[model samples]
Target: MGSAVSLRRFPSPEERPAALRVCRLPGVYAPQADTRLLVAQVRHEALWPGVRSLDLCTGTGIVAVAAALRGARATAVDVSRAAVAASRLNALLHGCRIRVLRGDLDGPVGRERFDLVTVNPPYVPSQDARAPSRGARRSWDAGRDGRLLLDRICVRAPGLLTPSGVLLLVQSSLSGVAATLDALGRGGLRTRVVERRTEPFGPVMSARAEWFAALGLIAPGAWTEELVVIRACRS
Candidate 1:
């Protein structure tokens, strides 16, 4: 086991006004730049009028609320009760009818399918054994190799999607974007990068260099972290 990584507490809606609130609250990990970028991409490229959508791991329900704002009936899910509560409150605050559920990825939505599914799961690859803070544990830790949640989501996505439905997911460059794409492909879904951003701070940047070094994917030095927006559909 390795030393525990310190994590930042998730911000609350009170900390930021609703009008300017772009991420979820009461969770350790706030929405990253990738999240906002992906939302914009989905809004511009994929969303259609009256489409039903699912937001997997919806933290503050920002994605679900955005989808509803765009005329997509939306449902948001998260494993943390606090997250579900925050999402529900946020939805109500926005006067949107987004449904909120508490369960692991895909557990809350169960068998029901949607025209679109979006996920912004924890993608940090760490060997830390210390129990993370509530928000960190649920929203930041991505297992020893960072693909734990991503793998599960991709494997189950095929069943949750409507025949022509698409999945939009965000992953960090530190997690090996190419490997993630390959994993999605093996799960029978084709992928493409719809968005990318380089950030210098946050929990992701902390162990990024070390992780990348061990993986031998990039040379040791200051490297930019990329947010990959992957679009996948049933073939």
Candidate 2:
């Protein structure tokens, strides 16, 4: 609600006074640091009427609901059926009208463009190489080097935007921040980091810390991870 946001430091999620209604599926993704940080950034935007916002990887529809709360028409997409159900329920509970769809990233919004697209896809370095087809791993498992879905999103998501539309994507710095910027930039969008934040390694990251450490992705004793929100816009 001010002027422009700062980029040279870790961005904190703007604290809200009242908690909103949220539901979660067991073993499914629940909103965490990345979620809160992304939500905070979305709130700072001037979401005027008719600004359509799409939330990709909307585990519980929290980000979409936040956009709707800020007066933007919102849509949420996810591949997990449980996630889709959870998102719909949360939207209803929050009194926000949201179209929740159950399908892979680009399928639900085929040929439909939005003014703003929000993404919080899996970026954690995981063990699985093949794409996760089900279970909780679907939310976190990315192929080695951790750019599996990130690459796909960077390539496909931009095409799903209206002219002058914006893409707000959140991922751990470990997934190659520069690569993301380059991918989007090469794809013809002006990109920049709008927000950043750090949190101690969550359980998933902690478990794989040793693997990544061996590969020199993380320090031997590193216990925290940095997250960045990249804002890409088409003019």
Show the colliding residue pairs in model 2.
11-196
Q: How much lDDT does each candidate structure score? A: 0.72, 0.84
lDDT of 1 at 46: 60
Tens-place lDDT per residue, model 2, 114-156, is: 9889999988877777778887888987888789999999999
Regions of model 1 farther than 4 Å from truth: 1-24, 129-133, 207-218
Relative to the true structure, candidate 2 reaches a TM of 0.92
Highest TM-score, which number?
2
Q: Report the Cα lDDT for residue 68, model 1.
A: 85
How many residue pairs of model 2 clash at the backbone?
1
Local lDDT at 201 for model 2? 89
What is the TM-score of each predicted model, taking all chains together? 0.82, 0.92
Model 2: worst 10 consecutive residues (lDDT sum): 1-10
